[model samples]
Target: MTSAIDIAALDPASRDAGAVAHYGDPVREQRLLEEKVGLVDRSHRTVIAVPGADRLTWLHSLTTQHLEKLQPGQGTELLILSPHGHIEHHAMVTEDGTTTWLDLEPGSQLLGHLERMRFFSQVEPADVTADWALLSLVGPGTDEALAALGVDRLDPPDALDVPGAKFAQGTQPPRPSTIYRVAAFGAGWVRRVENGADLLVPRADKDTIDVEKVGLWAYEAHRVAAKRPRHGFETDHRTLPAEAGFTAPAVHLEKGCYRGQETVARVHHLGRPPRKLVLLHLDGITTDELPVPGTPVTANDRTVGFVGTAVRHHELGQVALALVKNNVKDDTQLRVGESTAQMDS
Candidate 1:
């Protein structure tokens, strides 16, 4: 087997630290993410494959998405919750008849959970992260890039034998049948290519999609603007899908029993979630004076939530994502330490 390396594992000194630094600095990252299309190595995430006759049915019973209705070459977002309904992991699931791949954060507990679940079924789940390389192609030019790759439409849910090298359109509902997964990045698209193959394909004059290098800072800015939560930041084992706004497409309330179904259903139907995700626009802040993650956000001299992500927006100044208590209303004024910020409802 070929050895695989995580992009995050690369030494900062050896790699382009400037690019990653661009991700940490919001303004620079957003400019690159918005004005041009860029590529980021996502090999740090793991890919697990489920194969055999019972793969779809088995997964359907274990995840939040309705896998039974999923068509080959189609993909959907999934949240694996704990028995208490807290998020364990978020995944992008894709099916190709012979195999269903769950692409999740590297070292995520979902892989072990799925592995253990396999003992009760005949389906085979194998960690295939080493066999594939994942790349996140974000920005406005994403669709055109996929078009340059020969995928004109998203593969329908019912379609079989769809090419593995297919591209899906931007993240939108009832996503194009040819696209695999609808992503949250601004008009973003994800492309998965098997290892050992040339990812860059030949294109005509009008079809050429230039792969610009993007840093993590830019990706972070895009994520904050879209109000999408990250695993370790806004989401964790303590957070339920509802709290993180994963209740919609990421969680299937009608799906059969899974690890955290009861709690998710209970919170959705009977009780209010303890907290809600909110966007924060920091006031009177300078790029050098940005608040760090975990900085307590306070309102009326009380604690609400901590900053999850803080980005110095090129256009909007400083913005952040926070999981504040539900009582916090939109336009609520909150303070991060001594800095003032407003909650964007």
Candidate 2:
């Protein structure tokens, strides 16, 4: 809606729904993110407010990450799961001393699940999607970009208080949650969601920031090349956290009881996920057609898995992120449509 229109205003030829599509030459735009700074639109995401006397404790009793001791402006991510341990929802979590904000993907029933789980904890779930918008700066000079806004030496991952800026709608920090740094472009996720730092602002102030805007294509290509697992693209109802490689920062192995802790532990100790996510080196020179998201991946002429994303990286050429059988070797040769794919390290 607003995000689509905003990107359209910036790049008239860009194709997008909520996330960025691209202006032109996605590869150049992707390189811009690495070499300099590029602004990204992230307004399509969902933000939920959970506030109550027992909200923190109740939330800690659930999800994978530890949130019981969250301080003001401290942020961490968490995953809500089925009792059986199937991946359900991944949320970007943060707090501002009052309401705990859970930023998540659109169409997630996490709020409904919370309502159902709210027996008497005094927790309330409110959709605040209309109240805020997310814009991210991708590149090495993150502090420089923030300095341009008169905000300097930002202690990222936490939140920043911007003075005299239109992005802040209230007294809350500019980032309601974690400012996930792009690990692919520079460091690791720690690793942040989709490899970028996120900033939240009132939708009314979306146009106030002064930053170089890059297309969605740059962001998507970087994600695929770096082998990041997106919400709907790499994971689903049947997905496991380990299957998508969300073990360390997203899930703590020693945390107390939660919905899927047992299964998560069981898989880590003895069992392995049926499939594992891997980076695929697509044969770009030989094959004209690249694998789409759901193109079956095969090894030894048998269906092992399917393609998640096939992005033509400027440096890596045509590459993809694929989910394949755990047994498939890292160097195994695979096939996706007419493209010959290989499981790369």
Candidate 3:
């Protein structure tokens, strides 16, 4: 199966209206995604796999991280809630001692709820999004652009020697290593982020890995400047994985009993999380436009929260990434339609 890299038909000043939103300089591809190195593509997204031998104890009994001690060149992030915890199916897992992969977001039902929970379970799961593609790389010259296309070296030891410091420490960095097969691609992976990494190749060998691409408006403006909470952008249907900050590496909270672990352990011990993802800034004038994904986010006029990705940030110019209403007041002043945000501090 092979059909994933169409990022606006690979440039002609891209802007395919449905994906590749930039190529002809999204603020110089967000300043080469913040100072050098950029790639991106993300061939739509959605992989899946799962391969048996009880694929990590049947996905650690079914979701929200801590995959039965996930070893083999680790990688994490998981979710699939909705027994009440809400966010139904987020992804980015990885494995290779038989398969686990995952990637995500492309109209998820997580492969029909992993085929209705496979009764006796030896797991199967499938959906290999037309044999995978993904892409991404990113900034700080992403390990010198994967060592100038020679590939391998997927970050870990000193996680890229300090340019964004793998998301400035709040954890979840080191964990990428298992897929291999690089050059001209038939199987690859990279996948780390907040500054760089995430390849996953082989949708017909992703045009043999060249480099310098960057778009989805500079990876949604560095994933809303790294507050990263995507799953239909910051969720809805009642979010909660501690309201989008997916509890460090996509929720584990001491794991054990999946499916939404009793509303993620009663909202991690009784309460707090009626929405609160923040990082707005947006007072406007990056040539005005921004504010799109579900917009709304008011405050004095009432609404309270909405906008999810927004962008324009080459050095935080028009930012966004909201969810608000967890008592909305990180210095208030919200709004959104006419612009005016705040809370980015």
Best by TM-score: 2
lDDT of 1 by residue, 1-345 (tens): 123233235544322232243334345556766875666555556667778888877877777766776766456677776778788788877666577777776566666777777876878787765566455667666556556655453332232221121123322233212224322211222333211111211112212335655556666677788898876678645898878877664765555678888887677765478998888988754334767667888999999888887876778778899888998888787888768888885
State in Å the error of residue 223, model 3.
5.6
Encode model 2's per-residue lDDT on 111-183: one tens digit a residue.
Answer: 8888888897888878877887766778876667766765434454532332222222343331222233322
Error of 2 at 307 (Å): 1.3
Tell me the whole-model lDDT of each prediction, alpha carbons only: 0.63, 0.70, 0.70
In model 3, residue pairs whose N, Cα or C atoms come closer than 3 Å (at least 3 residues apart or on different chains), thus clashing, are: 191-198
- Output the worst ten-in-a-row residue range by lDDT, candidate 1: 194-203
CA error at residue 273 for candidate 2, angstroms: 3.4
Query: By how many angstroms RMSD does model 3 differ from the true structure?
Result: 16.8
**Residue 321 in model 1: lDDT:** 92
lDDT of 2 at 184: 19
- Window of ten residues with lowest summed lDDT in model 3: 157-166
Candidate 1: residue 86 Cα off by (Å): 1.1
The TM-scores, one per candidate, come to 0.76, 0.82, 0.36
TM-score of 3: 0.36
Q: Lowest summed-lDDT stretch of 10 residues in model 2? A: 182-191
